[model samples]
Target: MSKSNPVVIAVGGNSLISEKEKVTVEDQYEAIRGTVRHVADVIEAGRQVCVTHGNGPQVGFILRRSEIARKVAGMHPVPLASCVADTQGAIGWQIQQALSNELRRRGLGATHRGMAVSVVTQVLVDVDDPGFVDPDKFVGEVYQEADLPVLREEYPHWVLKPDRGRGWRRVVPSPKPLEIVELPVIRSLLEQGFNVVAVGGGGVPVVRGDDGELRGVAAVIDKDLATGLLATTLGADLLVVSTSVPKVSLNYGTPDQTDLADVTAQEMRTYLAQGHFPPGSMGPKIAAAIDFLAKGGKEVIITCPDNLKNALESGGGTRITP
Candidate 1:
């Protein structure tokens, strides 16, 4: 809660959408409102904040809608990067509105004015990253085996993988984020005491062209990695990752699962090396934590949204120390 140090919080995609409900615009707005309220609480405590969020469900919903809409009217569908920009705008607007109202209600407007701005960020990635050679990050809607042929014909480049019990979904190349294009702008916003929400959907992935121009690439970057990059670039004091679970666990979902309240970066590395974290899910989060700490980050907290306050105060979540 000091002026010198800021907090960068990354909210998971599942926080905005539940398993039962359809991911509608209204639902996303409501979810953003709840998230902003929590963020506003931190702001009221006199901490500067920046946020980055995942767009898995929202982008999937938009892509599916665009596909269906294109079927009725010959409207050209937007690209994946454009869809990420759209979610950034929509979700950012909701967070701004909610946080503004909450700040006004809490009478913090007099001393601490809260402003939320969404930046259409671009993240640089290697054009020849091996992730492209072997696309594995799942995106968009899940479909039954019967629907695969149709979807394949529709999106021939899409990689379809079968889930354990669930159906298949389109997977895209999720490359590591090397640089954040709007990092300077985010730093400016943070200096102005604004709660900036940038790097939505790991930022519209981009790569340099042969002509020395920055061009948008058809890929998604991992949100956690992007958030870590943002935190490191901004020199934030804490990187709080909001996920579904209150704390990260070793051997997650298995009978021998062990929840971790705190761990060092070295311990996380050991677990990662032993393949305790699977790349498909928890691997990126753990890797992001390690990367943050490796880059001189003071601390990182992994917890659920509802438990954020408790996690920060009581060290309830999986905290990675220096």
Candidate 2:
């Protein structure tokens, strides 16, 4: 790869699945095709990229399906970590296929050109992380209040929480990602000119046991935090986080909302402290940008997938710098 060609992109869940749809496999492929076109444009411009993506909706769908399957035929329900792994495979396959097709359409060769690979990454975290004591990250399907007791009895570890104005949902421990276990493998793939996607759903949060082996834990890791760690580990020049919104904004959804084009890490932290970003939504993205910039990343861009190129060149979107 060229010296000038290093970027890590975290594509938001919106880019893969729309809120209006049920996220069927066909729909995911179509969505990924659009996303890959954007990525292919960047690659055609001579940038090496590593992509990460949010799996919230996709994993939730998988869990819901598994639950329904269990109810219908007495099949064993898959674990949350397993669902994350499933999404990694399903989404990665879509991305890889779409990227390959886009490259081929651009006249890039079918073999050994514009390659995309996905690694099932395990992110190390403390088994006793405070997040485990207080589950805050919402996951899986929304349920009625009457349905909570049955689920709670079935899954004792899960924390059932009611969303404001919405139905109840399960909240799982979302611990901070400590390290990307597959970083070396990812680096090797990138070195070989492959567009690697890893750390899906914060990398199947795991911990090293006393036996010195890695074990999957019943916890989620924030995708933005994992993406930040991935970017820093790969020494990426720029970290781009794609989201549903065109840019980060203060007083989001309010009449007084203001979009941000550029901001310093310190400013972002201040906004975070001021509650400009909600913890359930934009807060982690801001924190991730701050973390990346603090670790010496040249820039972090937060924008929707369509605005990525514009964000890079025109100083659009929310830019976080050290």
Q: Which stretches of candidate 2 lie over 4 Å from their true place?
A: 1-5, 110-113, 143-153, 165-168
For all candidates in order, the CA lDDT equals 0.83, 0.83
TM-score of each: 0.89, 0.93
Scored against the true structure, residue 54 in model 1 reaches a CA lDDT of: 86
| Residues 1-322, model 2: lDDT tens digits | 5433368889876568854654688887887887878788777777777888888888888888888897799888888888888888878777877887788788764545477778888889998899999888787777898998888788887788887769998888988899999887888877777877788777888899999998887777899999999998778879988888888999989999999987889998999999999887899989999988888798988888888888777877788888
Model 1 residue 106 lDDT score: 85
**lDDT by residue (tens digit), candidate 1, 1-322:** 2343579999887787754464677777777777778787778777777888888878887888887787799677778888888888877777667777788888876543566667888899999999999887776677899998777787787788986678997777988899998888877766776778899878989999899899886788998999999999888879999888888898889999999987999999998999998886789999999999999999999988878877777778889997
Decoy 2 TM-score against native: 0.93
The superposed Cα distance between candidate 1 and the true structure at residue 210, in angstroms, equals 2.9
